[model samples]
Target: MKKKPKLLKKNEGLNPAAAAPKIEPIVVPINKALAIRVVLMAGLVVLKT
Candidate 1:
């Protein structure tokens, strides 16, 4: 029983390690897009002023 739980824990750990790289690529693009939009909006505001 203890061995089974240890194996499960290792699998669970690996799952996130595998998933984290996938998630970061997706998140980074979103952040870059948001930053780009913010910069554009700021530029527009400056132009309007």
Candidate 2:
């Protein structure tokens, strides 16, 4: 028995792994940044009231 997809080479391009994987930098300062974000959001909300 013959499977359908095997008949086409076009399907290989659709596989995510076949494309270049996105490499993101690991930001080590995320905790400090998150703290700053929370403080800023809190200040904004408090001042808006």
Best by lDDT: 1
Question: What TM-score, over all chains together, does every model reach?
Answer: 0.60, 0.43
Candidate 2 clashes between residue pairs 3 or more apart in a chain or in different chains: none
Candidate 2: residue 19 lDDT (0-100): 34
Alpha-carbon runs more than 4 Å astray in model 1: 1-18
Query: lDDT tens string, model 2, 12-44?
Result: 556646432421233446667888999999999
**Alpha-carbon local distance difference test for all models:** 0.89, 0.63
lDDT over C-alpha atoms for residue 17 of model 2:
65
Runs with alpha carbons beyond 4 Å of true place in candidate 2: 1-28
Model 1 residue 6 distance off true place after TM-score fit, in angstroms: 20
